[model samples]
Target: MSATAKKGAAKKDGANQPFIYRHYDQEKLRDALRKMYLIRQFEEGAEESYMRGLIHGTMHLSIGQEASAVGICLGLTDEDQITSTHRGHGHCIAKGADVSRMFAEFFGKITGYCRGRGGSMHIADVSTGNLGANGIVGGGLPIAVGAALTAKKMKTGNVVVCFFGDGANNEGAFHEALNMAAIWKLPVIFVCENNGYGMSTSVARATAVPNIADRASAYAMPGVIVDGNVVSDVAEAMHEATERARNGEGPTLIECKTYRYRGHSKSDRNRYRTKEEIEEWMTERDPIEAFESQLMEFGVIDQKGIEDIRESVRKEIEAGIEFAKESPMPEVANLEKYVYTEQA
Candidate 1:
């Protein structure tokens, strides 16, 4: 059924139904679940490749925070842009990136995004509206505001989603960007994926506000908090924010209270968090599993359908790795090709 039709049917059935069921059709919901799985499997593949030395440099994994990534982008179109963080593989996938090209980028092959120069921390797909992932903390905030300003000036009616971690809340750019976005009435959504820690330091140690969303009040915008583990909840919050932005009501700050199963980066020793805490989140609040159960309960998908998605994702990841392995590498002589702009 069409989304509008489904929404009408849902309203006729019951108002208490989750926003996702009321807004999105079954096909879209299933696709959302599939994308969540893809994000999880893609990260796992990248992690394995990194361990085997196929990928160079370090990568931050968003293993347990799949729901936040997928849910936020659920209502977005290709025209709606997003700036991602270093742990941005999930964001790229959520924004409709090709896994093969992503794997190629990780392998530093010439066929990769940014011609293999960007790697994991800098993957950008303009066609999919992903501006690029930044390695620096709080780096994407101002960039997102810039994008939103362009949209507002051009009357494009497109919104920009800026994905940052809990640590970025303490950055000067975060406050500046939020204030600027608010004053300009820009179509930007500041999504704080608070995974509890900024490197070894927890949010409690780094941030003063009780929740990152609370800071939005200072900017004179609405602040929302959602269960990042629950895809429906995240989607609901994102949908509301998107509507508000598209209506020219200015920006919104959404804090997704989630956790990362892995360390901050590949080199992290994970001494700050305990094993039981990580295990509890992984076992009890695994985003993909929670989403899967939701899909099943809502009759959106069944066991066999879920298995099919898993199998499809597995094959895709295998093919993506092979594609990267078979792809060509950039020559040493052309190292400056994308580095410097030639004077016209």
Candidate 2:
């Protein structure tokens, strides 16, 4: 039977289906697939450029954690704000950032975000409600809380999503921020992308709690866990958390159990984890491949559609690189322009 026919049959048989299959239509699901591809390809292109010395400075790549980023932001609107981590290209893309501008920023061109002053880790688009990516561990936590408080005071009804790594859970800021948000009933969702390791240290060694989500109970929030490799699962958790926040029920802490193919950053030698483990995650649990299979199985997309998306992303990446190469750099005379406030 065809995929749709199978879906119909399953429905008639009362078989439980993924939340996305019931909630999203074909177009949205396909678009989610496309965004996941875009994030992957964009990071690949960035890594290539960084290796070639076309881009300066080091970067943290969230290569294998695409689904967690895309899924968490899937239910968020343009008005919804997010605070990202150093490894945040995926989060930026999932929240609707332009690849060309991101590439330009990496290239240190004037047309880029922050006018090239802020590179990969600092890219921000207020227009899309991406407050910005933070370099410090757990730095964005308090900032997200502040934004949520503003949204509450303004009655904007917009929720703020805070994306942090497993390492940040131990930071004092994490505890303080969560406690404050919960006490105020702020519209914020604390999303912990637990990829098993905090740099070289295993999460098991660092955290006392077995799962990062368990930490949420200390703050009096609903703690939830989901398979981060599954986009639909992430989306379902985010959707519920978002609704609760909008209803003035306070924040939710969601832990996404995922993996990253690359090291923590360009400087990481990856001595802590074994090659076999990385290979297993990459080959068996690749988020994009798994999501694509889900799409095909649910009749959302076929091989040709997937190919088309890949090709389009390829062209866009190429164009972005070219644009960065040809774009102008910042003027030497304007060094202090954006740094200090001007007198009226």
Candidate 3:
């Protein structure tokens, strides 16, 4: 059965209605779903190999965080910029990174994007305008703010998308970054993927603010909260924000309320949550499945088309695995390569 079939019937909610500014076409929505599937399958494959000891390092998988990544990326331009998170493979892929090379990075092969230097947390594709994914919490936000400032100065009109988790929202850097972006009217959209929990602790325990978006007012910008599991809603929100930014408006804070199915990292047994909780979210709130249902309702893709996409993703993943396996490991003497800028 397809992953969509595994989820129970979705409940009707106000969040299900299409947004006024939703910028999704048949091709765009289909590509969004395809990107989400690519991230999901890649992370699942990475988890399996890591568990089998084939993957050597620690990995922060984005198993349940697909919509925030792909949905937001859907609104990005080819020349636009983005900063990613510790769980960054999804961001990389959504920003147009090569799947084979992404896998090769995890395999520690020389051909990996970082030449096998940075693992799952730090994969990047500069040509795609993905600045880089950061392993440190709140690290990317300020960097994105800087990028936005540069864009504003250059009068480029290109927006910068900053992807950070709910945990990073509490960081001092988060507030500072937003404040700076707001004051300067920088073309930056701060996306908070609030997946219920930060590491093992639920958002309730870690955050006093009821809504992360609500805090945007303090920064003197618009704050919007949307169902993160619904790709159309997120795409709408991001679209609106980017347009406003390009028009010389300020930044917007978007809180994407969603869930993560797997443990914080592969290391945790997920003792913080119950099986029932996981099952509930999985059955009702999976973004990929939710988007698939909407696509079918709109006749964007039928069963056969969905299956074809699944098969295509699977074959592509398998090909990536084979390529990574055949790729050579980086030379020992090149340990310090790509780490520092070369002297003139």
Candidate 4:
């Protein structure tokens, strides 16, 4: 069936709302759904592992922000690069990192991407164009800019997508990187995942401006806002920004106004926000639920399809955990191998 016709079939209350991929191909929509499901399931499994004392250190889960990661990465090519924040599993997975390796990293195994030393917040897969996830709030900004600058200087067509939280918007690195990128017309896209709270403090109380995107003007670049909950919306924005960068027009700042369904990290008590607010985001504004409904409405998938995807994701996560369990721990002999380098 045509994608739009599929949407018509997924109606509720005798009305048909917009589907993200109504007019697009079904494979693309299906792939997106599968990726989102994988991210959600992986994070859920990671949480379980953490609770079970299998993973050391706390993790910042991106449980509700799958759409932003998948959407933005959809606009990037294999040659393109990305930098992620501490809550970055979704980004790594969406950028084509192996789930087994990621799980091994969390388990601190020698087979992991960072040889098990970086742990949860510092996963890096250079093969997939992921520089690394930064533990510091805004640490990845300048690195992304440097990557873009190198690409620009070398005349490479690749661009860099830098993902940061709203909290990073207030950092000096953000301003410095943006200014340099704009002036040099660097191939970079600054994506701000504004998930409301920056470690218990709400954005309203933290920032002077209403929207972080507005600050892009000071750098002489186009600033756009997208519904971070809608994968298609984010994809469109990223596509525009990426195109602008590839065309030598300069960097673009995209503010994705999203929400986190979980606490900021394992230690977050969630005291600053009420349960009602989280419930609203989880039940009503859930990106996965909304996308599933739209897919059903468009006849792209049914209950069976959704269940199948969930089951497959579950199995994949289970296999990853098993692999992690079987992987060997990092030996003491190589403990300082990657920690420091000899000066040239």
Give Cα distance to truth, residue 91, candidate 1, Å: 0.4
- Give the true-structure RMSD of model 2: 3.9
Residues 217-295, model 3: lDDT tens digits: 9999999887777776677788899998888898999888888888888788888899999999899788898788878
* lDDT, each prediction: 0.92, 0.91, 0.85, 0.89
- How would you encode candidate 1's per-residue C-alpha lDDT over 19-71 as one tens digit per residue? 88889999999999999989899999999999999999999999999999999
Query: Which wins on lDDT, candidate 2 or candidate 3?
Result: 2
Better of 3 and 4 by TM-score: 3
Stretches of candidate 1 exceeding 4 Å from the true structure: 1-15, 342-344
Pairs with backbone N, CA or C atoms under 3 Å apart (clashes), candidate 3: none
Give me the runs in candidate 4 sitting further than 4 Å from their true place. Answer: 1-24, 340-344
lDDT of 3 at 6: 19
Which ranking of candidates, highest lDDT first?
1, 2, 4, 3
Winner by lDDT? 1
lDDT of 2 by residue, 1-344 (tens): 13224334544543567778888888888889889999999999999999999999989999999999999998888999999999899999999989899999999999887788999999888788899999999999999999999999999999999999999999999999999999999999999999999899999999999999999999999999888888888899999999999999999999999999999889998999999999999998899998898788777899999999999999999999999999999998998888788989
Once model 2 is optimally superposed onto the true structure by TM-score, how far is the C-alpha of residue 255 displaced, in angstroms? 0.3
TM-score of model 1 vs. true structure: 0.95
| TM-score, cand. 2 | 0.95
